[model samples]
Target chain A: MATVEFVEATRVYPGADRPAVDAFELQIADGEFLVLVGPSGCGKSTALRMIAGLEPVDAGRIRIGERDVTDLPPKNRDIAMVFQNYALYPHLSVAGNLGFALKAAGVAKEERTRRIRATAALLDLEPYLDRKPRMLSGGQRQRVAMGRAIVREPQVFLMDEPLSNLDAKLRVSTRTQIASLQRRLGVTTAYVTHDQVEAMTMGDRVAVLREGQLCQVDTPLALYERPETVFVAGFIGSPAMNLIEAPLEDGCARFGETVIPLSRAAARAAADEGATAVTVGFRPEALELRGDGEGFAITVDLVEELGADAYLYGTAVAPAVSGRIDATPTVTVVARLAPKGVPRRGEKVRLRIRDDAFHVFSTKTGRRLPD
Target chain B: MTATPPTRCASLPVSGRRSRRRGHAATGWLYASPTALFVLLLFVLPLFLVLRMSGSDWPLLAGNQGINVPDNFHEAVSHRFFRDSVVFTVKYTVLTTVILLALSLGLAVLVQESTRWKGLLRTSFLVPSALGLASASLLFYVLYSPLAGPFADLMRSWGFTFLGTPEGALWSTIFLIVWRYAGFYMLLMLVGLQSIPDEVYEAARIDGASRWQTFVGITLPLLRPTLTLTTVLCVTGSLLAFDQFYILTKGGPDNSTITIVQLIYNVAFQGQNDLGVAAALSVITLLALVIINIAQIRAFSRRADD
Candidate 1:
């Protein structure tokens, strides 16, 4: 096991003005699984490639287990990678495929065979020892790929969206298997995927990237519950946390005519900066339907039912006077009520949001309001 | 079943009048006449004429005295040179096929390795293949011309020459053939290489296979079909090599560079103009090619099945 560190590593492709991964810094603790997640063209994969030595790092250094290996080739990095597609050698049997790395490293024949067999046994692939990759199903091929990495017993395992190819059901199952395997082996692993759910569920800590910049790195629950930036708050959850502009009014922030109390620090900062407005963000589950409340009344537009929880997508109803209501934004508010507590469509439900759970951000910078 | 009264039809009054139907059949044949005449006139007739001429004591000139063809075939086969030429052809075919495939595999890897400068390298390798075989042979002929320079020096400049002597000539011819065809095979192999998805390579890399391991275990297996086709083409083309030997050495200082086609040309046109023996020799060469092709197909298919 090794601690894989990317110390402000940067990669700029030739002829491109902007670096694909700009000043990227990440520290994966020994035996820790860190996932790098972003949208397509977001440079998450590029970051992984740089670590694997497939692509050169233009600036900074990478260290694995205290060894500076920024310029080392993949073979010399003591790392094995499992790709999105299971790249099993089609010509070789499962056993041969599994033993290839050891053979390349010049392990003796007897030792290589023993290691391959042990790894195959661990992966439940003894029955397929002689079958070529083409003969195996997709999931089986993925396992063989995993087995190949296992035999290497590398300092780090690099997986680039390894489960992205499987069907939805298989993807879930394989994700669990890989997670459990990583836990059992206790090897430092860096997994890259665009799926936030996979990153949240699989990683010990998740790093979010956007346009080649590291947005945030934190524990999954921390990122979801206490996001430091509006981007992180909006990106980390499904149905996304809702953000609304609230004008500073008397010691409270006013949303249309309704006023919600703000912390002294927030109010003082707003007054000191002469800030007129702040953005308020709240998760769907934090809002409850109240028939008669001081909160803004919203008309239900659509509902998404997910068995256990349902989401109410709607817009805030206009006040008695409409000329001053310049923003008519539709907010998708999700409520995790019991399955029996769904409200009818078109109902005007007053909302009561948890004050402590509400996140207030600077309207100018979108930075979260400090306590 | 009650028979209905037959209705008068404009096309045929009686559907089953045998004589009228026979006449209609004759008209159908007449309507299809052009295509039938074309096949017979252009394809079958020529083939028949060749076969007949090959078997008979024919001459290049109509009134020239000709040898009996059976005697010609017997005489052609009885010669030590004919046997030696057949052996030489087989050896050259096998050697050229192996070397060409190896060279093509290497070129395919080099070109497929990167997209940067890939277009430039691919064009350079393929330019030689685009040159006609006869043209390439003539080019080599000039380069190998005694007045040009020492052959050894030229060989060393290229790293090594398979061409040095008669044996060297055989290897040199193979070298030329390999050079002429490597790019063509590389194109085939490039297609094969590109068809393999990138995910597979990533899987191999992650699985801990080094570059060499990945090539042997994944790339080569997937390239088998392309390899088979390229190998067969190189083999057949090398076996029928005539232009290079004819232009380069003109059957050589000791007749050491003579191929089967050269021997056949000598038999038919050079000395006695024995058309009968040359025809017999052509028939033998065609049969040999047919047999070899069948054998190659069988061997490849058997390996595929295994």
Candidate 2:
């Protein structure tokens, strides 16, 4: 129940040219569930390991509560971690695995047994108290992993994709269990996962990382609505936001005949930044199908139907630009549609962007244009 | 109705599958027959011959005479040197097993932690295992010599005699065996240590376990299978100790280092050449080993169940 802070924490493997995690700076508040999310090799796990003190912090400092733990070992950090593989001691029974830390910390045998029994009850693992980890199902093993961390009553919890090994249905249920468990315990936690959906659903604040750098740290809705960079825009949401490179013309971004009107502030910001082109992003639910001659025509490539809603993945047809050879490549646009009137593949559909749902970023720097 | 047709089709392949399995089993036996034949000829035949010889009045120079039966067993049990050798074998087995397991486990942990020159150290440690036990024993014999060996001057300077006394001979032989086999046993324990996932150690570290606690709580328990294997090997190998003691001490300094195998060899070849009594001693040693091995296996399996 203490705040954890990473002040420019960086890690560079020996003989590697670049740091795995470079100048990482984040302050997790007390009782906050901060998730580090990115694709593989993005150093999200490295950042979490650094905070856990499992990884050496080659440079910079990390503080747990008020103590500098950069040079300290993991044992002195007073934190507990749930590994991705649920690394339960295979030889020990469930009770032994749960009470391992308490015993190591020199708790009396009686107290250790009491705490283990309490934790087993909380995890509904009473029946499995005498069973080995190999005998438990994946979901039960996952709870045991969580119980291992909870029994420590440490200052923070570090979970590295704890639910990744469970099946899909189990993963969903366990994700909620972990989230609510963290809330009930109110321990400051730093969780790392590559799955954006998991990060969006479980994190109080999601920090999206790319190429060993933090792209954006914000609430899930903020990240979905306004991603600071093109990477975060594409990485934060399911089915991802559609980004189109369009030319800036007449205070609007133009992609062939499809002219998306930008806010005055965005246009001014683009002009101020001296950006001749802009990358416009819109979510799948931000577009509506229209009649002919009213919107951009798209040739539907595929349709994914879910009970209530469907998504149309279509390649936008390049509209001829007058007196200009339109060299910009046509990009695919994904738009959500009502399940009732979903378009079939190879059919043409007209789509119009919602009034102010577009996110405009400069093409040169890939930074969001202020609006 | 639809399932009945599929069931009829499945039944049609049952005989074909069984014949194919029988053919596969035949090929497996065919592949294994050569080794099986070798074992029967080399091991089983000799075992039966020894058992038969133990019950007959067999001598080395003369052929087998009439049945001796319990006479050879009584002579072997009553022999003073034979009793002393059995006691000495038990002592050596217990001492060497304890020392070898402890030292090899320490060496394995040391090598596992080292990131630098690990291969060089491992190769250096395992190089002695490559030398035959007789060859290593002979080498150590020269090293233990007080007059013409490399360590002669050093031993003289330190006022120490390596194999001049019974305790010296015993420890010297134990040292030789440890040097020869510690690396091999270390490699076994190393495999067990490496197979433990790195995440387990990390979890223990996060659990605030000290290094010693980690070793006791995590490493020792997880390495139980390897420990059992190395313990059995060390005990059995030390119990059958003959080459090293024969080459180095020759039951030296008042016959204090006579192991059971050395006594059996003496009775069969050096003494009055009593092949019957030697065979009887061999049978007794084999029975003891079987009993010890069964007890060891039972102990390990019971612990595993718990």
Candidate 3:
């Protein structure tokens, strides 16, 4: 296994005004399963492609195990890629598909067969050794695509949305399988996906990208606990973090009738930026539903009961405090509560922010306020 | 309005299904009538007429002069140029299939690879196919003429006659066919190449496949259907070769370039003026073509299955 490094990697499309991947920098440790996750068109796939040597790194250096492979071909880079669509050769049988790269590397036929059979057995594809790709189901084809990557025993594996084609149920199971498989093989894999959940569940350390630049790169727990930007805070959570834009008054942010006192650093940073407002981000699970009405009031717009975990989705009944009334902002808030505490739609409920559960960001710059 | 899913045919009652089926059948017949009429008038009727003419003493100028099936078959088989024409046609067929397929595939790969000039090259290659085959043949015939053509000076300088001998005539005609039809076949090849998704190539690249390995292991196998089509078309068109020889050689240079179709024409109108012998030859050629095509398709399908 080899450590993959992208030092200010950038890619500019032909005839385009801006680079598609703009100075992306990330260092993946050896035997690490690092995922590049972002929204669509956010350069995550471009970065993965750049690492796999499919796309040229127009302005930066890429290294695989101390080798400056910026100009090397994909074959010389010793990488295997699992495409988003599983791109199994429609003409080749399962065995042929698995052995293709080995044969291409000029490995002997006997050795190729042994590796292919071993890979097929690992993937539980022994019964499909002779079947064409069309004869296999989607999950089977996805496994074969992974088998193609594993059989080569490459220094690094590049997977671009490999589980996106599977059904939802299969995607979850296969996600775990791939993670465990990568760990067992200890291949330095760079996986790309738009799904944050997959990124959160699969990556040893997930690098979140937006607009061709990295927003945050950290372990799953770190990212959830402390997001560096307003975007990251909003992006990393399911049901999303409830970000209520509030004007600062006397070192406290006002949301409807409730007053949230900002940390000393956050208040100072906000004042230093000459900003009047800050965006308060709190996770859906970080809010405590209270009968004492200690926090802000939001009229429940909808209640989603998803068995074992229910969420109350609502909008602030009145504009969050009338004093910041330039535009009369209405914040849609989501709160994860115990299934028994779900309020009916159209009912007003109080949610109090838990201690150390909130992240503060400067409204003017979208960057996190130092706190 | 909410979008409702389309109702399936199985949801209908028996009587409703019968009526729906009747309506579908009527629409099918309505759409098929034009092609059916065209086939009957243009192909089936003429085929039957040729079959009848093959069995009767139907001369060019005289009306049907009773049955002469045995005589027609014997004369057709015993024609002086018959064996030579068959040999020439088979040779031409084999040459044309191999060269056309290879040239078009090469052109396709070159066009596919060249990013900057892809559109320009594709358009230019396809331009030659627009000219009618007979028109192209006539154009080539004039160029080959050493009498009043631009190539006349060059031929005189080099002492090279394009249609001087049997081999020269055959090759010159094959070259003309390639020029006229290479673009059309390349277009077929290009379509086949484009249908292979780009991700497949990316996967190949990461799999460490060299260019040649990818072409042989990935491209050729995936392109089998298109290859089968182009080959069959090329073989059939080459086997029934007539226009170029008729325009350029006219079975001349000691009658060394006679093809099967040309023999049929000679039997009907040039010398024998016997429509029955021409029709008998036409029937034999058609049968041979059908058998050859069937064998080709069977071989391809069996290989695909394996």
Candidate 4:
């Protein structure tokens, strides 16, 4: 196993105005599974390809282990990639596909066969050894691709949305299998995907990217709990965190009739940034229903019942506070509630934000306010 | 009561569906009848006519007397020039197929990798294929002339005599054919190469496979169907070679370059003018082509199965 590092690596396409991956800098530890997660067109795939040496890095250096691989071809990088489409050689049988890299690397025939058999067994692909890639199902083809990488025993593994082609159920199961297999093998891996849940579940640490720039890199839980920017706070969760832009009055962020008292540190940080208003973010699970007299009122617009829990999507309709216009639009909020007590549509519910659960960010810069 | 109602409904729709399917099949045949008619009129009619003429004692300028079974076939097979022509045709077919396929594949791979000037290169390569074979033959005929050709003096200075001897004439004609047809085959190869996904090459590169290894292991195998087609076309087209030899060499240098088709032409028009023998030779050539094509297809299919 070896660590992979990218030092200010960037990729700019020809005739394009902006770099596809800009000033990307990250150092993955040995045997760690680091995931690059973002929406489409976010340059996550470009970053992974740079590491694979498939894409040329225009500006900076990349190192695999101690060797500078930025200028080297893909073959000399000692890395194996699993493509999104699996990309198994359609003409070669499963065994041939698995043994290809070993044969190419000039391994002994007997050793190649041994490693092929071992990888086949590890992937439960022995039964399909003689079958071509077209004969295998999508899930099996995916395993063959994985086996092809595993048989190489390379210094690092690069996977670009490797599970996207499988059906939803198979994608979930295969992702778990990949995560466990990576752990068992202890190989340094960098996986790129658009699915936040996949990144969260698979990576030891997930790096979030946006528009060719690094937004944040942290543990999945840490990113979910305390995102460094408003983008990460909104992008990291399933029912995305609700962000409300409200003016700060008397050291409190005012939203409709309810005034949330900001921490002294957050207020100081917001003041230091010269921001008169802040964006407050809270997760669906952080909002608790309370008695009508205790909390702000929300008119439920929709309720999604997910068996164990229900999420109420509604609009907060607090009465206008003094010196604030009633004409300002009410913000929509989603709250996770117990399935047993799901409120009906059009019902009015009072909700209170949990203490220390909300994040405050500067409205102008969208950076999180320190607390 | 439920079973009776469902059975009644099913019987009604079954009868309707049967008629509908029959009508659909009839319309399909109607749509296909034009092509079938053309094939029957153009292909089957000529095939039977040739077979009939082969069994007759017909001359080019005379009426057929009657069927003389085996006489024309016997004479055609026994003709002194016939054996030599068949052997020469086979040699030409083998040489042309090998050289053309190798050159086409090489040029195709070279052009496929280049991002700049790709269109210009492709167009230039394919331009010769657009020229009519007869026209191209006529053009090369003048160029190969020893007396008036511009290259004659230059070739003499270089100690080379193009089309002046048997081997020279044969190789000159082969070179002209390669120049004329390699582009067409290269186009076929280019389509095959382009259809292969970029990801496959990327995977191979990451596997540490060299360019040569990838070509042999991945590209050639995946391109089997197109290669098979180009090979069959090249073999058949070379076997039927006539216009170039007729125009440039005129089966000259002691008839060393005469192909089977040229021999058939000589028999039908220039020698005894025996249309019967010509027809017999045509039948033989057709049968040989069919057998060769079948053998090639069978070999390819077996490889595919493996």
Candidate 5:
């Protein structure tokens, strides 16, 4: 187990105008599995590489278990990494590939063989030891790569989208296998992926990055329930959290002529923070389709019905501010309903908002309003 | 003598010509005929001529005689010059092959590891390859001029004549050969290096492999195919070396630097102009090359299979 501390680590590629990873200050607890996730070009992979010492950290220090390893090479840091491509040595047999690192480290031949066999059996690769990487299937090759890393038994593990190359079905299975493996090993791991689902499901704490900056760092439930910023709120959930811009008046938020009663604490916090407009976000599941009133008049544009639940995609056409002050055309909301009673396209529906489920953020700053 | 020209020949439609598959086949053959003709005339015909000449003892100018078996095989086997040239060629081939492989592999590693100024170094390595061997020999001859040359003073300072003796000339040629051909091998090796994905190196690094260990275990093994190819080329080229020795040494002091090709040239064109013996030697050289290539191919394929 290792405590990885990135004390204001920054990575700037030479001659680039902006840093690829800006002062990323993070502390990963011993035995903690932290998943760094974001959209493409968000610098999550860069941060992981920096931690692995594959990429140099231009400014700041990195420590692994009380040892400052900022300037140390990957081998010196005693860390193991599994790459996206699996990166198994094509020429080496499965056994050879697994034992190569140990052999390189001058471990005895007998011990190397024993550890290789143990790791291979752990990965269910015992039958394939004598076979070369070319003879192995993709999934088997990935297991061998994992086996190679596991044999090292290093202080930390770094995995960069290791399952991204697998098929969808295989990805799901491998995801569970890798999470269970990490848990059993109890090694501090920094996993990098663009897939939010993998991050949410696997990470003890998911660190969301946006443009080289940490947007939010929390458990999946906390990040989903109490996103601290607009980016996080919009980024974390599937089908995305529907956000609408509306003016905030005394003790309430106004959408067209409809005035919804907000919590007194939230209004006071917004007022105290000098917020003029508010962005309201609600999950699709939290919204219920109703029949009448000036609630939220939405014409169903598209209806997607899964087996258990269905979603109604519609645009809210209300005369809201439609300028640079608030450019979005009213609002587009996705409502979740049971499969048996899903809405049809072109059907006008009124959405009954769950007030407690609604998340309010300041228009100017996009910071979450505490209730 | 025409039996009768068909009147339909004139009436044959242009559309009929367009539809004819024979015309397409004729066009395809027309494009291929030049290369086919050249190969037949230069390669196939020369091969037949060599085979015939190898079995004969046709002296220079025929000498009012017919072609017959000349006991050239006995002469080739017994002659001291033949033995010397064969030994010298084998030595040169083995020495050059090993030296070039080692140097080129090092250069390949350097080129692969380098970041800045790599283009400049690569171009410098390739510059010598562009020069013809004969021209390069002449250049070395000038550089080796004892009266007034850069190498002369340097050799003097180092207490050695770099081209004054057979050993000196052999080493000078080896140096020239390495300088000229290492870059070509480096290019091949660089392609091999770049083809190995960065992920592989990262994986090795994370697996507790030191840079040296990775180079030996991973890099070397992966580069074997390219290394094998370059080794074959180097060995074959060294075996067939002639122009530089002919220009720079002309068999040197005591005929010590004469390659088999140089000996063949001397037999056919110098003194007696013994074409029969030269042809026989050429046949032997061809057989040697074939045998060497077969051995190398077997080794290469066997490793690949393993």
Candidate 6:
């Protein structure tokens, strides 16, 4: 087990205008499960590959444990990787696949067999040990891939969206299995995925990336509650955080005629940026359904029901409810509500964001406002 | 990602589905009738005629006289060049198959490299295959000539002639064949190599496999199907070796390079002028080819299963 570090690592593909992963820097503590999450082409996988030494560190250094291994090959990095496609040797049986790294290291026959068998048992793959990879189902193939990495018992584990190939139900179950397995093995692991929920649930610390740059890295809850940028606030949540452009008043942010009181620090931050408007944000669950004509009114456009809870997606008229005589546009918004009393489509519902739940950011910059 | 579930096949009554399948079979036969007729007229009819000729007293000019049966088989087996030709053909087939497969595999790997020279290397290596075998053999005939060949000076310096002896004759023919067909076999190998996903190699690299280990463990095994195909083609082509030998040596150098097909050609049209013996020799060669191909496929697949 080793701590993996990336110090200002960058990768630029040939003929490309920009670096695919630009100045990426992070340190994964020993035994820590760090997830690199982003949208497609966001350089999350490039960052993980850099640590595994699969990709060259063009501009900076990477260390595994105490070794500076920027120029080392993947095999010498003491890392095991589980590819998204599984990448199992289609010709080899499960046992052979599991023992490949051990055999490569010239492990004795008896010890190789023992390690393979143990890994098979751990992955519930003993029954399939004699079967080639194609003979197994997708979930089984995924387990064999994991077993191949586990049998190596390397200093670090690198997984690039390993569960992406599985069906939805299997992905959920295997997600927990991988988290628990990494904890049990106490191996430093860097997992890359575009699934925000997977990153939130499985990572010891989640590093959010966008357009080849780190936006934020924090514990899941901390990232959810205190996202450092407007991007993180919008990206980290399911159904996403509702961020609306609102004109700043004396000390408040406005939504329609609903005046949201902001912290003094937030107003000061907006003033410091010399911005006339602030982006007020709130999570879907932070919205409270008030009585008619009590708060900001939104016309319910759609409702997504999920057993116990439901989400109301609607469009609320933007600004100028105070009769400025200028034209106003409608901004789409989302709010989580109880399934039992969920309003139907086209119903106008008054909603209020909790006083402490508002996330304020300056309009001139995408950075989050203080407090 | 929420992928759509696979659509279930529509169910039909067993008898109805069976009738539908029968209708499909009839349509398939309808579509295949032209090709079937072509094969019958071209291959099957000629095969049956050969068999008939082999079992009868058929002379090249006089046509069939009477049933000869075992007499033709006996004469074919007892021909003076029969034993020597069979032995030489087998030797050539074995040598050609091994060398062609190994050299083509090496070429395929070289051409498959991601270097900037890949296109140039591939095109240059494959250029010789564009030449016809007979034409290539004739080309090599001039190249092997002591008076007119480019290698005349080099051969003089080395004090060795290309087609002056039995061993030289055999190796010169082999060289001509390799130059002509090496690129074709490498193309087959390259197709097989490209089918292997790149991720598998990355996985092997992370497994700490050395270059030699990866080739032995991953590449060779996965390329087994292509190897079997190329081996069968090389062996069969070499066993039917006629054009190059005929054009170059004419089974000379004490007839040390006589091949089965050349012997059959001699019996049918040149010296013996007996269609029965030629037909018998052809049947034997065809049977041997079938047996060898079956044995080769079985051996490779059995190892794959293990």
Between the candidate structures 5 and 6, which one is better when assessed by TM-score? Answer: 6
lDDT of 6 by residue, A1-371 (tens): 88988888899878988898999778999999999999999999988888777787779888899999999999899999999999999999999999888998999999999999999999999999999998999999999999999998899999999999998999999999999999999999999999999999999999999999999999999999998889999999999999888888898887865788778898887787777778888999999899865669999999999998899999998874342365767889999988888889989888988768878887668888878
lDDT of 1 by residue, A218-263 (tens): 9999999888778888888877888777667786776644566888
Candidate 2 vs candidate 3, TM-score winner: 3
Interface RMSD of 2: 0.9
Q: How many clashing residue pairs, candidate 6?
A: 0
Clashing pairs in 5: none
Quote each prediction's TM-score.
0.83, 0.94, 0.95, 0.95, 0.92, 0.94
Question: Which residue pairs come into collision in candidate 1?
Answer: A81-B206, A87-B203
> For residues A70-175, could you state the per-residue lDDT of candidate 4 as single tens digits?
9999989989899999889999999999999888889999999999999999999999999999998999999999999999999999999999998899999999
Best by DockQ: 4
Per-residue lDDT of candidate 5, residues A253-313 (tens digit): 7764456666887788888877666888888888876666746788899988888889889
1 against 6, candidate with superior DockQ: 6
**Model 5: residues with Cα > 4 Å off, grouped in runs:** A256-258, A272-275, A325-330, B1-31, B63-74, B151-160
Report lDDT per candidate: 0.80, 0.91, 0.90, 0.91, 0.85, 0.91
* Deviation (Å) of A325 in candidate 2: 12
lDDT of 3 at A96: 91
Greater DockQ among 1 and 3 belongs to 3
TM-score, predicted candidate 1 vs. hidden true structure: 0.83
* Location of the lowest summed lDDT over 10 successive residues in candidate 4 chain B: B141-150
**Model 4 over residues B96-190: C-alpha lDDT tens digits?**
99999999999999889898988898899999999998899888887877667878888778877788788899899999999999899999999
RMSD of each: 6.3, 3.3, 4.8, 2.7, 5.4, 5.9
Q: For residues B1-306, write the lDDT of model 3, one tens digit per residue.
A: 233433444455766979999999999999999999999999999999999999999989997999976889888889989999999889989998999999999999999999999999999999989998889989898888888788999999999889887788889998999999899999999999999999899889888899999999999988999999988899999899998889989987899888899999999999789999999999999999999999999988888998
Interface RMSD score of candidate 5: 1.2
DockQ of 6: 0.73
